[model samples]
Target: MGVVAAERIKLTSTRSPWWCAALVIVLGLGIGILMAVLSNDTEATQGTDPFILSATTATGGVSGFGVMIVMIMAALTVTTEYRFGVIRTTFQAIPNRAKVISVKAAVVAVVAAVVVAIAAFGAFFLAKGIAGSGPTIRMGLDEATWRVLYGVVLYAALAAVLAVAVGALLRQTAAAIALVVLWPLVIEQLFLLFGDIGKDIYVWLPFANINHFLSAHGSTTADFHWGPWGGLVYFVVFTAIVFAISLGLVNKRDA
Candidate 1:
């Protein structure tokens, strides 16, 4: 508990976490507002899909910026210590490198969850207002909408963990962040850039797999099904592989 508190203090003392979080909220709201204002006349028909539209509407803003901020926050959290040559002291103070990692991951998970939920809520309501009262999208109403919201929050936290994982593996913020962000934008996008026939490929990428599966709106592709957990095992497997790599590097590398 004490160690967690101390680690939390380090995060709070720095401007990066708060600032990055704020940026996420702003970007989410901005995109939501844009979509809402542009399609204010869109009406939800009785037979129409409300969750689908709402999910696509709000997440369009977070798709790019949120990933970038997650990488930045994760990189800064670990690399900032390296930059200050304070990692050695951090190691000495904590003595349990794994626990330190856990604390860092926890801080990220909690903060990301809260901030993302807020962003989702804000975006939903903003879009609701601008969407002109035909129907309002609220959180926790249906399985699909709530599932996507939960997944978004989880994705944000996972991005943070990914940041820390990459940071531990590489030990440089620049390289870590580049690898994290670039992999999705350049490498992963290459999978779906072909379009139409890329459904199988789209269902396999890291973010794509999770977001595409959870997204009721078909943001990534109009093909993925929101029914049944297609490959929950696959998600667990990938997360485990990445996490193991992080643990290995952190244990072997010199502080």
Candidate 2:
């Protein structure tokens, strides 16, 4: 309990997290508004009835760039401490290095989850309201819709844990941020360029599976062995493995 409070104070004392959070809210809501406006224009131009806004489409910004920012913030929480040698003091005070890291991960994950939940739902309803009324745009809370809304919150929390692990392992801000941001946005997508083999490998990529889970329908064309829940499980296991490795190294290595 003391460790958790200390971690929370350390996190909130920094300005980067707050800035990152603000950026997330802006991206989530701003992009949602843009998507809605564009969709409205498309419907108007086509002379068609208003299009049904899929939850996936509505919350694209939140789950996409917004979550990435959250991961970067989470990574920075650890890397900045190492950069300034604050981690050594923290370790000295706590003595249980694993507990400190675990508590930090938990604190960041909880904060990330809460912020993203608000942004996700805000983006969804804001988009729905802006897109206006139509028979198809009933804003129904169907199973798929609910999944897209909540899946982002789950993804953000897990991704924060992964980012914290990466930060602790690397202990360099730039490298940790690059790996977390690029792995999902760039490296994962690069696999698609490899044609059939890439498609097959893509089915197993962590972010790909996460996207599959968050999607209203599965996001990827690659054949996954499991369904959405299974994809989530795979991601959870992957994150836990990475986090465990970080714990081992942090305990064995110098602060």
Candidate 3:
């Protein structure tokens, strides 16, 4: 309880987390409006088929860039502590290095989950409201729609845990942030450039699986051995392995 409280205080006392939160909100709502406006325009010009807005399209910014920003904030939480030598103090107070790291990850993960959930739903409703009365807009709280909405929150929380682990391992803001941001946005996409082999390998990649889990029907072309739930489990297991490795290294290395 004490460690958790301390971690929360450390997270909120900083201005960067607040700024990141605001940016996520802006990205969520801003992109929602953009998608809604575009859908409206597409419908206006279309002759036969109308443009249908799925849950996936509506929350694109929240799940994509918003989640990335959360990961950056999560990485900064640990790297910034190391930067100012606060982590050493924290270690002295907790003694159990693993406990401290675990608590930090939990705190940040929870906060990220909550923030992204709000952003996800906000984006969905805002987009629906803007797109207004149409056979094109299909933003219902159906099973699939619910999955996409909450799946984003789940992914954000897990991604935050991964970011915290990366930060603890690297203990450098720039490197950790760059790796987390680029691995998903750039590096993951680059795998597709390798042609058939890349496509095969892409099915097993962590973020690719995440995309599969969040995607609407026929939205993703990757041929996976399992279903969306299985893809999520694969990502969960991968994150656990990385986090476990970081825990081992953190205890073995100096603060």
Candidate 4:
């Protein structure tokens, strides 16, 4: 409990959290508004579902961009400590390696959740407001709407946790940050160029699973779709595995 509280305080004291929050909210709202504007063409909504464009645009704006910053923040939570030689002090203070790591994870998860909630909801409402009385106007919380909003928060928090695990495992700021950011943004998408095998492999990637989880209509696979909730479970398991490996490395290595 004390360790968790200390970690929370430490996290709050850092400038990264504020920067991350600002970026998430600013980019989320900005991009969402842009999407709303672009999607305002009623002719485009001719035969399609009117609400889909608004929902997809608003949701994608935040979840797509906001979570990437959260991943960087998570990685820095540990990597920054390493860079500054603060981990030695932290380890000396906490002693229990796993406990300290768990606390950091909890703190990062909470921060990520809060940031995602604000950014996502702000994007949703801002887009809806800018959309005006048009075909792309969707202003209520339907089942799909709930899924998208909830999915943003869940996906962001999970991504943060995974990044923290990666940071802990790698113990290098630049390498961990690059790996965490590029794996989803570039690598996995590149893998999709291989057709069937790529698609199958994409299903297992965290970022792909996140997209599946947050898809407004619930994404489909060639053979199966675990659905949003199932995708969440899959991501949790994946994060847990990486976290376990990180913890093992932390236990074995000296600070």
| Backbone N/Cα/C clashes per model | 0, 0, 0, 0
lDDT of 1 at 170: 81
- Span of 10 residues, lowest total lDDT, candidate 1: 44-53
Candidate scoring better on TM-score of 3 and 4: 3
- Residues 1-255, candidate 1: write the lDDT tens digits: 988898789888988888988998999899888777655444533345443246645666765676568667877888878878888998898888888877887787688778877887677677767665444443334777666666667667777777777787788878887888788778877776687776567767666666564565444354545432553345546766887788777878889
Winner by lDDT between candidate 4 and candidate 1: 4
Let me know the TM-score candidate 3 reaches against the reference structure: 0.95
lDDT of 3 by residue, 1-255 (tens): 999999999899889999999999899989988888878885453778666687898999999999999999999999998999998999998899999999999999999999999899999999988888666677877888988999999999999999999999899999999999999999988989998898899888999998899986633566787888888999999999999999999999988
Question: Candidate 4's error at 165, in angstroms?
Answer: 0.4
**lDDT of the candidates, in the order given:** 0.71, 0.89, 0.90, 0.83
Model 2 Cα shift for residue 44 (angstroms): 8.5
lDDT ranking of the models: 3, 2, 4, 1
Instruction: Provide TM-scores for the models.
Output: 0.84, 0.94, 0.95, 0.92
Residue 45 local lDDT, model 1: 34
lDDT score, residue 173, model 4? 91
Error (Å) of candidate 3 at residue 39 is 0.8
The per-residue C-alpha lDDT of model 3 at residue 67 equals 97
Comparing 1 and 2 by TM-score, which wins? 2
Q: Give the Å error, residue 76, model 1.
A: 1.4
Per-residue lDDT, model 3, residue 231, is: 82
lDDT of 2 at 224: 89
